[model samples]
Target: MLSIAITGANSGIGLRAAQALATAGHHVLALCRDPDRGRAALADINAHATHPAGLIEADLSIPDSIKAAADQITHTVGHLDVLINNAAVFDQTVREPRFTADGHELFWATNHLGPFLLTAHLSPLLAAADRPRVINVASKGLLSMPRIRIRFDQLDDPSWYTPTRAYYHAKLAQVMTTLSLAEKAEGHLETTCVRVPAVRLDPDRVAAMPRLLRTLYAPKNRMAVPAERLGETYARLATRAGSLPGPYVDENLRPVRAPASAYDRAARERLWSLSQTATGDPAWAW
Candidate 1:
């Protein structure tokens, strides 16, 4: 069975992907931020899956936690067939400029830098697999941003930040990073970014939002694809044989040509270099 690990597996797309893979009889590692929640998710997956699923507690927003999770995976699984960097946060209403333990902006750190470091740390394990693939979950919201560009200086600038802007920048970074990884891996590993369609939020989570924000999101969520459909797409990327998908793909697993800016070689290289600076890990390679 293919061994797969999914971050943010306690809920949403990650959880559903783990369940789908487990049901398909692949060995699944469901990584969650909370131990209790991870175990609960594992139990739910076990109930539906023919093959057993497991849990690993990991807070991707923190580098130390990511390293610890990687260490545990190496000790336990040895090799990973697929790694889905699916965990992300969209706290649009968080008015204050929050920072991660790493001192980076919360959205940027969680959505981009965390995955970059996690993938870097886990590269060796991924290489050990026969057909390793890295799948990054992205969003279409990026297209709506006006003149969207990677402003390294503005990443943590709360003055000009909005929840949507920060999130778009982070996802754009992810897309570019995926391209770099695909180029670096070449024949060794397959890396792809997916622009997953919006999925409805858990009601409790939505209820916690401001009434206006909740109302704004409710109709959009209603139009979103169910978690199960998105999960199936994620599993297909992992389990399917033959040629790998393009460097960028959509929710349907079809290849997508990322925007022209994302293909800029200079910007891409600069972003990688800045990532190294942010993480303070010169030896880390995508």
Candidate 2:
């Protein structure tokens, strides 16, 4: 069985993917931040899993939690066939910016910096796999923002924050990070970013949202695919035979180029450098 680890596996696409992968007989590490929710998800997955699944609790918004989880995975699993950096926060309905425990902006910390550090620390375990893959879940929403780049200076400044704008920038950062990893790992890793389409949320949850948010997200939901469908796509990418290099792939698994800014070599390197400092791991090469 392929040993795989998926972050944010407690709900939405991440949970669906974990269940699907487990039912397909892979040994999955369902990484989640909440203990109660994680155990519930574990029970749900184990119910039908061909191979038993396990859980790892770590809040991706905190660097220490991410580091500890990586260590746990290394000690427990030893080797990994796939690492899916699938956790993300989209505060589309929030009026103010939320900060992580480290005081970094919530969206940037959870969506970009945390995943970058987790993947870097776990590189050795991934290398042990005969043909390991790293799948980063990006967004098609990023394609619409042609002018927005990583605003390194204003990441923590909430005065100008808009939920969608913050989410867009964070997702773009993830795309660029995927490119950076693809370049640095070259022969050692096959990394790819998947542009997951918008997904329809549970009806009750959608109903609980504010009217403005409900209206704003409804159009996207109408076009949104089921979370499980996207989950299946993630599974295919993990175990697929051929290499899918780090070009961003659409929901259909066709390569789609991100905005030109994401491909800027200098910008990518700059982001990588800033990310090392932001994550507080100066010794992390590449």
Candidate 1 per-residue lDDT over residues 105-190, each given as its tens digit: 89999999989888888888898888888999889776666467899777777777778778888999999999888877767888
Q: Which regions of candidate 1 fall more than 4 Å away from where they truly are?
A: 282-286
Off by over 4 Å in 2: 282-286
- Model 2: lDDT equals 0.85
- For model 1, how big is the CA root-mean-square deviation? 1.6
lDDT of 1: 0.85
Could you give the C-alpha RMSD of every candidate to the true structure, in order shown? 1.6, 1.8
Question: All candidates' lDDT scores?
Answer: 0.85, 0.85
In candidate 2, what are the lDDT values of residues 1-286, reduced to their tens digit?
9999999898888888899999999999999999898999899889899989989988888888988999899888869999999988885667689887778888888888889889888888898888888899888777677787888778788987888877888889888988888888776788889988778775766887899888988987877898889888898888787877447998778888887788899999999998988888634323
